[model samples]
Target: MFMCRGDVDSQLCHECIGNATQHLSSECSLSKQASIWYNECTVRYSNDSFFSVVDMMPGFYMCNTANFSNTKSFTPLLFSTMNLTADEAASDKKKFATNERVFEFQTLYCLAQCTSDLSSKVCGTCLRSAIKQLQIHCDGKLGGRFLYPSCNVRYELYPFYRSINVPSPNELAPQTKDSISKQDSRFLEDPFYLSYNCSSNHNTITSKNFNLLLSYLVSNATAGKLYHRVIMDEIVYGLFMCRGDLPSRLCVQCVTNAKDRIFSMCLSSSEGIIWYSHCLLRYSSQYFFPNIAETSPMYRDINITNHFISDQNLFTSTLSNQLSELANATGNSDERYMINSLKLNDIQTLYTLEQCTPYLSPQECISCLNDMISTQIPWSFLGSVGGRIIYPNCNMRFELFQFYIESDEARSSRNPSKEAGELFAQIGFILFL
Candidate 1:
């Protein structure tokens, strides 16, 4: 397989491929499987089947000689910028993306790409892996890159990529740090397709009924319904729920993305569900409406900040109080959604958001949130500064800094200012495989 970076012009791509073919054959001629990455293109050939699959091994890492003047200030910026860029690359038609972030006295350029043969869902996962690996090998470096058979990521202080492809941050007026973080989170939310799942069963008889159930969902989505549920022929049950604080446009986008992704991920299964940053779509052969049973966590993430909490007991105690307030507060709302913030210590403020499916009663929602506090908090966080847990009926997230907005910020968002905070804000994501 041979592939060019999306931004590379056809002529340059042709030259790069020619050079790669010659170099790979001469250097690794005896090997049945070999990969080469040039400035403009990547080429790989394997004896085994690899197309459309994620191949992560036999990778390389590059780090520049220079180091950042302030690793403390640069860590979060690098994390969020690379994350957004990875998401964009996965969703783009070319399976490639580039972005710019204004470092204090300099500009940071980033590029991410995946082989076009991979699906958007897998592409996102691959690029995220590349980012983590790059950070592991090149923390605080001024420039770095990770190259794999299926995906790659690079960041530099200089414009190492074509300028025409990336949007210029210089054109915009200066933004405060808080505003910049909000913009980053907004960018993060756009291509934030997380994952999709389903039960491990397939039935030819129920497939037709499931299609009909999806049609009902499509009609609701067309009519701009943020929440809807329907039962079809007593065989298939389906529903979709958008985050209550989202605008109609984003709710529509989230639902549409989920629908498109679900068909790709779980079409043959009797039960299917896709989760995004702002919306969730699900269908099942079993009836689960208006129920609040405790289910295992479908997905979880922890932002690891080394030595963040001086007192583990106090940290857990403080977090418990905040989560209780958040659950009680959200449980009172008709929307069944709420945003909250409480200063855990002088070190940092803990910001949290919680929500349950609207069909559930407030009491049921509270019960669900209570279960989250009791079961998830101890097993998941592990003294981390940030964490999130997603279940079938409810989800919640908390961070040392604000990671959400009261409303969608597509054109309109806030980021709390950070006075003095700890370093190393790398977040780890785990799906129940």
Candidate 2:
């Protein structure tokens, strides 16, 4: 596989890739695996295929010799900037992103890129692991970069690449090795993949049957089914559940994107799960419908770089109480999903969303959520502007902004004070005193 830094022009990207490949082949002729990183690109070859999988071995690191004097403030700014860049790269179809932040008087330029073959979740995870390397080896440095086979991260005190002229819709077409195919550039622009898990064991028959089931699920999604499951013999089962609030069009788009990426994302693992912001899709060798899913592969994310609560104790208790209400509401609702907004103050409004695999029994749904709330919440970041714990069975998220589209009823009751009052009436909630 080959990848170029996001800012490199197409002609430059091609030239660098060609040079790296020539040098690596001659220098490591006898080796089974070899990789070369140039200033603008990376070229890698392995005896076994490694597309879409995150790999950290055989890595390299570089940093500026100088150190920053303002480590205290720069630390947080660095974390915030890199994280923002990583999120954008992971969500983009090109699997590339850049960011610029002004900290005090100095400007920080950041870039993150993943191999095009990686799913957004895997890409984000890969970049994050690479980011950790910065802290370990290059702490207090003015600039640094981590280079790996699957992804690379770089940050500097000055601009190191092309100008980040914001691209319009027409310019988004993939035109180089550094971009995704034109077919992928559509539909996938919006649904941000969150996480994924897959079993290593692969079965030929199971994979074949699972593909058929996936087609079925996609068909149902096109037909506007909010949730659907199929048992394709005793060896393969598949299902998909769109977030309750999304329109049928977005649901179909996210489900289709998942189908296209799941096999490659899992490295052809027969049983796999992929989560996008708009939908969740999973398939397994054993039937798992109507059962409380094991939370072994749960994922959590926190917006630590964003705003944090001023009153930690009060916000903690309030958030806990709000999530509990959402859990209860989701468990008992027909859709197995709930969204709520609680006004913390004029400047801060806490929005929460909770959902389960629709087929689960109400009790099972609540149990799954309660378990996550008690054991998995990122308490250290609980006072941050946003955070979430996601399990295969259920997931709960809390952010300072509303992340979902409001329904007709919510629009009708848009009065701020009335909405706050109705929150208590509907969920039997009490004001945080």
Candidate 3:
């Protein structure tokens, strides 16, 4: 049987399931029994039936490297909260519970859940065991989680839960992934060919209004307003998005630099898009946020060292599929970004990334990614080892080697000067920010 983390939002649960199934099928191809955990979901299957059985073997635990400010008081409170949540979860038919405790400086959140198949007695036992494991393995940490096959427990000082603000569109109106897919043709127009008839109504704005707009870009965009709109005779719609994986400080700096550069480059034009090393900024006199996924007012950049490959078709096909999967995952993920690695052959690996501005709806993100895949990227970058395609709403890239920063070391390696140099180098070439 397959069971994912049941405490997450239902859509995230399904997305995690998809990731686990795909990964397990690929990574554990020959195994008769396998279990895996993604950040938001878990999946396990075995040849023999194990329903309602408490399987604790092969469990794992992780803790935040950072410790709380006041552990003497915090430790007791954390355990008390955990025990309360665990007992409630064990008794509940759904086998899940959440609790929060207000501390002097911050609030602590805890969650506990057991597989629905487990009986109340067995669930209680499993949760108690998980609590012990957490104590032994992650004591004194600010955040941590322990996972067993039957139950899982987690606590954190941060709001790790999904925000109620982004209400599930399904709750508002019945919509399934299939229904979203069915609307593809309507949103994902042809990539190779597109037609646009622009109006000549370029309503000129005063210098004062333009300066105000630029101020808004620097203030709001640098402060993390990924989407903003200002309307006059001609509406000024703006979007600035940093790479989803970047640290907050770097994201702020990247957007700030781009805002300054865009004023110099595109101040005269009412519609313009600019790309930086860590961010992308675009503004227009036209409103184009929620529906810009289908359009292709975009660009691309390929690595100069495009090594030749013997099997171009295989490479292209593999890359396309990977990018598509990443697109789907990113749209569904809370962060609107995903990283995946694919083995092109014995010697080479393809690292791929897909990201969308968090402001876009999940469906729009999917459409934007599909539109990129349908573009001439496959043909244009067929033999190239690495390349990126960028649009305003979303972007994707692939390389034979890992080019993205996935760790603290990678993020810290770049100083502000290096960031500026990289951005300048790509100004006329491909902007990969």
Number of colliding residue pairs in each model: 0, 0, 1
lDDT of each: 0.67, 0.69, 0.61
- Can you write out model 1's per-residue Cα lDDT over 152-269, one digit (the tens) per residue? 9988654456545223312221222332223334324573776677778884435556667776886786788878898877667889887666666777777777777776677777
Q: Work out candidate 2's RMSD over C-alphas.
A: 24.2
Q: Per-residue alpha-carbon lDDT of model 2 for 1-433, expressed as tens digits?
A: 7787776668657766676666666677777777777657777787878876888776688655456788999888997899899999999999999887766544577889999999999999999999999878878887778877898888865445555453331222111122112112222437877778888886554555666778889999999987888877656778888877777889999999898888667646767889887788888876677566567677776533234322223454456556654666677777787778766665667777788987788778876776666455543334344666778878887666567777676444322222441332121101111
Query: What residue pairs are clashing in model 2?
Result: none
Question: By TM-score, who's the top model here?
Answer: 2
Model 2 / residue 85 / CA error / Å: 47
Q: Provide TM-scores for the models.
A: 0.48, 0.51, 0.45
User: Between the candidate structures 1 and 3, which one is better when assessed by lDDT?
Assistant: 1
* lDDT (Cα, 0-100) at 257 in candidate 1: 77
Model 3 scores a TM of 0.45
| RMSD to true structure for each model, in Å | 22.6, 24.2, 19.8
lDDT of 2: 0.69
Error of 1 at 46 (Å): 83
lDDT-best of 1 and 2: 2
Order of quality (TM-score): 2, 1, 3
